[model samples]
Target: MTVVQVSAGWVPLAAALLLTVATAAAALDGVLAARAGGRPLGEGLLTPAAETARLFRQRRRTTVAADLPLQRIGGAGLLTAALLMVTVVPFGRWTVADLSVGVVWFNAMDVLLWAALWLAGWGPNSVHPLVAGHRFLAQALSYELPLMFALTTPAVAAGSLRLGDLVAAQSGLWFVVWMPVAFVVFCAGVLAFSAWGPFSAALGGGATGGVLAESAGVDRWLVTAGRYALLTAGAAFGATAFLGGGHGPLLPAWLWVLVKTALLLAVLVALRRRLPVVRPERLTVPAWLVVLPLVLVQLLVVSVVVVVRG
Candidate 1:
């Protein structure tokens, strides 16, 4: 496969545009999900806009001894992490930074969420938010290793950390067909970190919005936007990594990429309505004992295949 280098300026601009689109799409998807579940249209869609306007006029809330700086970091960092992650994601053979270690680069961006969400939860100086932060941290422990192993399966199969090479290796067959477990685990990790679907304990209804219990005004808006952005970015990355990137028949590669990403995001949004939210505590044993081992086995299979093919 030949390397296609895009102009540095054009690539960053394109990535930024796509990231904006993805965030908007995610916001719309959330509204749609609520609508599908019989939520009022005004409440589902216009509510966020109205709330944002209201928040802009409202004063920021603070708790005694609250770490304002840390809270800002947590709220803003989520969007920043999502943007950085998307930079390395190729949309039909174009990426902002098609680094040689693109897979690892992707992993590094994902790991940033551990800090982002934690700060968001802990900085509020409140009990529910602190508990919410602890939940997400425990969640990281359970899912991170499996996620790493899941990522390794494709890297091993393609014999390259570069996403373009990984996509090229799927010209004949997509990795999702063979690495089904990895794809599933990867999606689970996506939902977990993004605080989406049934894995939304960090912002669950039980805790009166969990980590979001105390957030108000722009802080609330930023964190909420960041959550959806994370979901959108995760779905797009999952598409490139598992669903053949942009390779498809009849349509332009970029269109194909967009379609796959939209479908995945729909599935993710629909899942929240369809499935019961699983508490982080319940996820721990299964993630560590069951999912992690399955991910490792998938990695082993990929390794053996690569060796045999060579």
Candidate 2:
């Protein structure tokens, strides 16, 4: 519960740790895909490495009037956003940046993904990618408010913007235990921001490969790897904010953080394979008309509880 702020020099190590977890999540996804295709699990396990090599070896695909600079920046943005999100996340007892408004910092980083994704689509200068970019923005508009409320409810409950305080507050009970709606909404926001599985209309909704239509070589690799990285980052934050970071019966706090993050990451990776697709069009109505109000009520409930307990 008492987290120490780690030094800047430790940032590289933390990045490595996050990337390792992201890779494992990618491998799990490959394994799931292999299971569905009746392939050997070993091949699935090798999918990440193989894909990385393949993309690196492949030549870049160029398009007419392509804004190569913008395209490349967009491709790199998801990973950037993920890395930024993790800076505030306390790993066991140490964190890189313990901002007073860590939760707000997280929300700001997630919002950056909207621009990252849009720039990715716009960079290619193709009709399909353009459509993909637009759809993602539309979809983002619907879920972002709900996502904001979901993130805020925990902050509201704990009465502090600091993530360390949020974790300490959960010493008795996790926010997820009493704030189911916020937890569920937060998870949905993670999926949406990552463009994972069901929320992947921006990738394949408008046209073949959507924003990825013309990407090749390292360009393709960054965007794809980043998608998984975003998922990893989101899972880690979810574990921290909702499930009680590093809080478990027997494991060390740091180990418990990893365990909870990995479990949640695996479940999310698997959810992509099992759920039915919800196109951007279908997502808007439900995200606004249904999810928004439920999370609001959840927020109200937490507010009331915090007042009484105080």
Q: Which is the leading candidate under lDDT?
A: 2
Worst 10 residues of 1 by lDDT: 21-30
Off by over 4 Å in 1: 1-5, 15-20, 23-48, 205-207
- lDDT tens digits by residue: candidate 1, 1-310: 3346577778557656655655555556657756887886546655456656888887788988999999889988888888888777787866777789988988898899888888989998999898898888988888889989998899999999998898899999999999999999998888888887677888763546788888888898787777777878888888988999889999888788888888887777667777777888888899888999999999999899889989
Model 1's number of clashes is: 0
Per-residue CA lDDT of candidate 2, range 113-222, in tens?
Answer: 99999999999899998889898999899889999999999999989999999999899999999999999889989999998888888876334798999999999999
Q: How many residue pairs clash in model 2?
A: 0
Which ranges in model 2 have alpha carbons more than 4 Å from their true place? 205-207
lDDT of each: 0.82, 0.92
What is candidate 2's CA lDDT for residue 89? 92
